[model samples]
Each structure stands twice: as structure tokens, then as C-alpha cells.
Target chain A: MTTAAITVEGLRKRYGDVQAVDGVSLTVERGEFYGILGPNGAGKTTTLEITEGLRRPDEGTVRLLGESPFPRNPELLRRMGVQLQASAFFERLTAREQIRTFASLYGVPAERADAMLETVGLTEKAGTRENKLSGGQAQRLSIACALVHDPELVFLDEPTTGLDPQARRNLWDLLRAINDEGRTVVLTTHYMDEAETLCDRVAVMDHGRVLRVGAPSELVGELGAASLEDVFLQLTGREYRQ
Target chain B: MSAEAFTSLSKAMALGLLRDRTAAFFMLVFPLMFLVLFGALFKNDATARAEIVQVGRVEVFDSLPRDAREGLEEVLEIRRSDDRDEALEEVRAGDVDAVVWQEGDEVRLRYSAADRVRAGNARALVDSVVQQANIAATGQPPAYGLTTRQVEDESLKAIQFLTPGLLGWAVAMGAVFGSAFTLVNWRKKRILRRLWLAPVSAGTVIAARVGVSVALALVQTAVFLGVASVPYYGLELSGDWWLAVPLVVCGTLAFMSIGLVVGAWAKTEEAANGAAQVVILPMAFLSGAFFPLDMAPAWIQTVSGVFPLTYLNEAMQDVLSRGQSWGAALPVMGGLLLFAAVLTAVAARLFRWDDA
Candidate 1:
């Protein structure tokens, strides 16, 4: 049997007095578009960071493609793509140069890097420095950089948090196309509509723990709720903030 | 993969630094400005001649032998002033450095103390001439003659020493500020976390930064030496000057490690900048990068010994000015290597991929 693309069990992480990710557990099947839906300060970013191997868990086990990620397994890293909440690029580097540098890190060819830029619809802005790009353009460039190596699994942490509605829809279409390429995609976002529209399944999270995990419509129907927002309100007995 | 990452990262970092106009100004132009300013100020190689007014037909001047009189004339521009009161007025008015007259067997010299160095020089020269005349009158050869020779090449001027000191300051500022600012900014922007997520090793990332800093340091050294070597500055390069290459590398590593520590410890760009300044400014002064430490108090000189920049400046000056051999710089390089190692370990211990 093929293993799950990612399996995280009993994940616990604490920062100072705060339990950022307390006893979280989840799994994503290969080629599935998954989302961790939460509000700000709800531990989505921390969980994503731990899962991406950018942070170590306090106590847990995480397996990506049947291999542990921490202690930095390069083989696993080569297979995974992670775009953090804040997009970062080399100082003063143009869009093409930024993606090319990332590609070079993974030994990917420059042609592929340029092609990835085109894939993000940034071909005309290839010569534009990263700082000069608009919010939407920057986010797309960041996503392109993350996917330049064509990893088997991708993680995006709040990719559309500050984008306008139109840019958000554009990014959603791009994310859907990425998932359509048979790559498993894990995303964290606060927008209920975003999860309902893009996720095959989403894990509803709050206060550092997963409340429930199911298909967005199934969760709505299971609780006899009008939407994922109502499902969150029903599950937590509180109004959804975002 | 690491090799490729290193190359790409180094290239990116180099380009970033070159493109940053502010950083380029600080790293390259600022210190070179100090070099040129100080070079121009100290460019005069000739010893200054003191202007003296002979208050009368001074008997001592006429009694001096012909060759002795000519030699004194070269050091002292003597003008005859028959009016004693006029000569004294000229000395007080700063028109002349001193006024000399013979009163009986005693030669009285009157000079204004406002220009102490010139007054002191004139006093010493006049005293020596009088002593020589006294000895000649007794018809006795001088008991002991003193000869002086400079340890360094006679052509070496103040600029020769100033060049290396300023060069050391320039290199230190470049490496330290470059690394500290880069690290802090990258961490704040989450680039460190991004790079960590990639397959590249941390060593590759740090090595790339070090490689870029060292390369820039070499370029700074070349520019400093090239500019100082011009005829206007008259900085003479001599004996194992090439040894400064290794010294520059070691010094850059040491300073960049300090920057790494600052970067790792600071959570904000402002904090990092403040911390870097706190480390660099005092080091530049105390390390004798701006002036000679020997002229400082004994305790200050002792305090300067603890700084890695002090040794860097000293060794660079030795190779560049005193024409010292490799033996002179080897121990200093070893010290710098130790500093680099220890500070690097501290930086690693303090390093965090993200501010969180």
C-alpha cells in the first residue's frame, strides 16, 4: 500500500508559557488538497512550521513520504516545498534571479526556473526586483520559488492573508492548478470560504488543537450547519472571527 | 548540492551588496575618504624650518665656522634685526619663532611659547650651536658623537602607517556591518527559515556569507593600497606586503564572526545596528586604526591588546609600513583564527532561524 504523503502524530510544541501546538495529529493522503483552517494566533503557522521541518516538535513524530523530516533529511527536503507566511527573497534580486537562486539550491536548471516564473504569470516582471513587485505578484513569485523544483508535496502557510479579493481568487486558481498536477498540497488559511472552495478536506483548528477534520460539506452537514463558519461556531460555541 | 548552493548564494549576496548604494558607500567610499583626507593632511615630507630673528650682529653667529653656519642656516631661516625691541616685538607677534642675541658670554633666546613645537625646536638648535662653539673655544674634540637612523625605509611617510590602519578599519567595518545587517534582515524577513527548509546545509549558507565578505575585503585592500600608492599619497609598499592578504582574510573572519554574534542576538534591525556600532566604533579608536595607540596612556595601550583589531592593525602596519616578514604576522593570524573560532561558536549557539 502507498503510504500517506504526510503523517503527524501527537505533535506538541510550547513557546514559553504558551502551548502553540498542543497534541495535534493529522494525515494527508497523496495528491489530496488539504487545509488547516484557523484564526490568527490559533497555532496554524506553528503546526505548519513543525510539519515543514523548519521547527522541531517538543514531543511527536512526523513522517513525510515515510521518512522523518527533522535532523534535516535532505532527501525528504528535496521532495517537499514550503512557502512561509511572509515571502522572503534575496536582497535586491530580481524575480528571475530569486527563483533561479532557489532552483540552483536544489540543482534545478535555470530553464525550469524561468518556466516556473512564467507559470506564475510573472514573465513580464522577470526583471523587476522582488521589493518592487506588488503584493499579489510577490506572493505568486514566492509560490513559484517554492514549486520551482516540482516537489511531491507542498505546504503554504496563509498564502493569501493580506491579498485583495481579486488577487486571492487569482491565487486560488493557481493553487487549484498546482493541486491538479497530482501533487499533494497542504495549506493553512483563516478564510472559511477559501477552505470550502479549495480543500478536499480541512482540519478545523482553534486554541492550539484540531477541533475536527472532514470534507468541508460533510462537516457542515454533519453538524446541520449552514457553512464551515457555522460549523466552527457550532463546534466551538463561539462566533467565527474570519 | 551544497557546492552549488554556496556558489549561488555567494553570487546573490555579492550582487546584493554591490547593488545596495548605501552599503557600497559605507563599505568602500567612507573609509577611502578618511584615507584621502588624512593622506592630504600629512602629505608634506619635509621637516619644517624655524624662522628666527637675530636681534643684533650676533657674535655667536659670526664666530661659528663657515660649514656650521651654513648648516644652521638650512635649519633656521635667520634675519638680522638691529633693533632689539623690534625683534622682540616680532617674536611676540608670531612673525618670527624666536629672537636671539648675545649678552656678554651668555646667548639669550626669547621665543613665544604659543607655538611650542617650533619654539622648542629653535631652542634646541640654538643650544646645540652654542655648545659646539664653547667646545671649539676650548680646542677639544667632542667626547661622543651621536648618529641616528630610522628603522623603516626613510621614504616611508605618515601615510604609509595611516593606510594600513585605515584599511583595517575599512575591512572590519565591511565584514562586521555586512554580516550583521544581512543576518538580521534575513531573519526578520524569514529568509533564514526559507533557506533552512531547502536541502542546503547551514554550513553552506554561512560559508557563502563568509566567502563574500572575504572577497570584498580583498577588494577593499587592493583599492586602499592602490590609492595610497599613488604619488600624491606617497605610501610605499615594501617587504612581504603580500602577507597583508592572509592578514586581511583572517581579520575579516574574526570581525564577521563578531557580526554574526550581533546578528544572532538581536531581534530587530535597530538593535543589530546599535550593537554593531557599539562593537565597531570603540574598536576602531582603541585598536589604533585612527591613531597610534603608543601615544595613548599605558592602561589604554594595555586595553587595546585585548581587541583582535589591534593585532590586525599592528600586523598590517608591520607588513605595509615596517616591511616586516611573515614571522611578524603569523602569530597575529593565529590569534585572529582563535577569535574567529570562538566567536563563531558563540554565534552558532545564539543562532535562531526565525525571530520566533
Candidate 2:
């Protein structure tokens, strides 16, 4: 039976003069792959972070797996995985050691680290330190770390933003495989194609509000636009972001 | 706190320290360099010597027994002064180590209390010479003899004082500045943020860092004391030197808590390093790390009383040189623990997983 993985209502956050996330509301069902798409300063990461429990909403209500997450509920954290845009690990620890360290935090054993490394195709680079990894390898290692505990829900903020096309495609397959295992995945990205390709449902956001939320084709077809990009441009205007 | 959390975190940090060349240099090499430099400078002072000026019929030098004269002249550099008052003025001003003049049949050694070690040695040498000469001339001990007294024991030289001071300074720098820089770097690199996202609590993460810091402090203390106590440095460890271990551990807790405060307050690595230096450098200088605060101005000494390093230095001196028991070192240890409790509270209040 499907249940709500996340539910938010009237979520708002203000950073001094800027309204980073304003009265945003959304819901993602369990086992669904959801995406929040927005341009720069559209509050994509801020809203995702709020939902992931890394941030506090100035005014609103949020529930992850039907429990409050604001005060850092360890039970919720144990069941969830997060890959921050700038996630980092100890530089001296090898890739395998890095996974082992985090796995140990969750009371998982060393063998799980090897399994996660193999799953991410990083088994060959397991002995390499963080500084020795390429950008793509490092990103893959981050994903492996996030999923090491076999969490029920995962949050990936711009997981493929800085990758080459090939690496991005490889990551898309990885995300699909994780979603195929019935683990709910929510990601934030400005790349329309990534949203169109990977997400079962996409929410178009601009100026701290959700302009639209539906399947990628539905979002694209509703505006009578050619593609998701055209729909985004039509909704957010043609002006370039600062 | 989970034992695995503490052990894994400390292992990672220790590995980082080993890989970081700059940290290794400061933690292991810098203190040794200071020890070698200071040791070489005072190497000759181990064998006591003196400088003396002679006045008024200094030919008494010619009449003294050859053995007594040569023995006295070996340790003392004696020079004839034509103006006795000027030579006496030199003695008063500590220009020479000592002065000797003969009155009737009595040979007098006039020495200033300043440079007490040199002055005391000079007085004893001259008294020995005069007594030997009197015995040689009359086959009897002298009726009136040269006498001099000094307030300090001859053993506590500048080197002895500096050994404890430098040891204390090394621990302070290693525990406080090292941890501050590491915490700031971890925060900047999002390592701390990653740990925060895990099941471990913030307090567990902080305790992990503290555990590593205390271990590092103990290792540094062991290395420093081992090197300093060698015959080349001639640093004597007091009979109850085991008390130094608790003193070092308490000081580590106190200073590492301050490091936590700096890490919690600083938003960047540059700011953390700067703030650490601001706290460490002034405390190092005022805490008698380089020299005793007794020679400093009264206000500076009063100011030195406020820093934990000062208490650590005094505690180190108390146990390392004076053979004081753990009971006697209570006040200094208590001061450090109080500092630890207060600063840890402050750090707990201010700590953030993200940048400030």
C-alpha cells in the first residue's frame, strides 16, 4: 500500500531581505521519484533542504514518513539518506574507508561498505583517497555513501549538476535503479532534460513558488510548449538568471 | 556516546594529522628546535664560573700560594683596578661577577646579590683561596675570612625554568590551535555536516574530536619530556613526576574546549586560525612560556594570572622541578578543569553543523 513519503503545507523561509522559500506546498508518495526544478535564486535547494530536515521553515508544517524532523529525529535520519550538493568526507580516508566510516555510524558492518562500493561501480577505486578521485568518481562515491544504509527515502540536491554528459547519464541510470528498488527519491535540479528523463513527477518552481506539479509530459503539455525548457521559459519568463 | 563513533572519528583525525606535513612539523619539530637552541646557549653555565676585579695593592695575588691562585684564577677572571671606588661601583652595578680587596691581614670579597649564581660562586672561590694562603703562610686557618650569601639555590638556572615553560607551551599549541584548525577545516569541507546528518549526535562528534585531542596532547608531552630530560638538556624530572600526566590531561581539556569555542564561532578556516593565534600568542608570552613572569612588569604578571596556560606552566614547574604531589597541584588542576567546564558549556551552546 502506497503512503505519503513527504508532505509540506504553507512552508515559508526568509533570509533577511530575500524570500528564499515562500508558502510552498507539495507531496510525494512513497516509492515515487520526484523532482523540483527551478532557476537560480528560485529557492529549489532551500525548499528541498527544508523538506529533508536540514533547514527550519519560518512558518509551515512538514512531515517526513509521518514524523516531525525539525529537531533532528534520529529515527527519521536512520531511515533516510541525504546527499548535499557539497557533501565532503575526510580527505585522508580511502573511498572504501569513507563508506565504512558512515556505515559504522548507522551500525552497519564493513561488508556493506564493499557492497555499496560495488553497486556504485566504485569497487575498483575503493583504495583511492578523496583527493585522488575524479569529479565524476567523487559524485558516484557520494551517492554510494548516501544509499549505504539502504534507506527508505533519499534526498539528492543537484546530484548531476557538474557532471559531463556521459557521467550524468550513468547517474541517471543509477538513480532509476535505486528507484526501481521501491525507495522514494527526491531531487532538485535546474536541468530540464534531467527532470524530464529521471523523475516520475516534476514540480516547476519560480520565485519561491511551485508554478506546476505533475508528470514531466503533463507539465510540458499543459503549457502547450514544445519541451519542458520551453514550458519553464514560458512560466518563468525569458530573462537570464543572475 | 557510541564507542565506535569516538574511535572511528579519532582514527580519521589521527590519520589526517599524520598526512598533514605542516601539523606534524609544528607539533613534533618546533618544540624540539626551541629546546636545542636554549640548551646550547647555556651549555657552559653548568660548571660554575665568576669574574672578579681587584683593587688596593693587588700584588697580594703574587703572595698567594701558587695552587690556590691558579685554582681561583681558573674559575675567576681577576683584573687590577687603580680606582677602588670605581671598581666597587662596577661590583654594585653587576659589571663584574665579584670584587676582592685586602684590609690589613683580612682579604675581603665584595659581591652584589645581582647575578646571584655567579656572585655566590665567586665568593666561595675567593674564600677558599684566602684560607689556603693563610694556612700556607702561618700554618693556621685565617682569623677573618671572606664571606658572601645569595638568596637562591644554585640549581634553578634559566634552563631548568625554561624546560617546564616550553613543555607547557607545546601542549597548549597542540591541543588548542591544532583542534581549532582541524574543526574549522572539517566544517569548511562539510565533513562535520556529513557527520551531523548521520545517526550520531553533535555532542558525540565533539567528544570524538576531544578524545583525539587529548591523546595527541599526551603523545606530545611524552616526546617533549623524553627529549628534554636527556643528559644533553639535563632536565631533571622530580620524584613525583607522574603527577605531570594529570596536569597535562587537564590542560588539554581546558585548551581543547577553547578550541571548540573558536571552531563554533568562526565561519571560515582563515578566521579560525587567526582567532586561535590571537588567543594562543598572547597567552603564551604572558604565561611564562619563554621566561618567568617574575622578571616582567607587575601588570603583565597580573595579566598572566588570567590564562590557563599560566596555571599549566606553574603546575608543570611544581611537579616537574619541585617534586610536588598531586595533592599540592590541586589548585592548578582545578583551575584547568573549571576552564574546561565553562568553555565546553559555551561551545555546546554555540556549535553549529553549518557555517555560522
Clashing pairs in 2: none
Specify the poorest-scoring 10-residue window by lDDT in model 2 chain A. Answer: A84-93
lDDT of 1 by residue, B1-356 (tens): 37888999999999999999988999999999999999998777455789998876667788777888898888888888789998899889998999999888889999999899999999999998888788888998999998999876899788988999999999999999999999999999889988888888888988899999999999999999999999888788887999999999999999999999999999998999899999999899999998887779899988888889999999999998887978889999999999999999999999888876
Model 1 spans with C-alpha error above 4 angstroms: A237-242, B54-74, B79-90, B93-95, B101-108, B130-144
CAPRI tier of model 1: high
Deviation of model 1 at B137, angstroms: 6.5
Query: What is the DockQ of the complex in model 2?
Result: 0.63
- Candidate topping lDDT: 1
What are the clash counts of all predictions, listed in order?
0, 0
For candidate 1, the per-residue lDDT at B71 reads 89
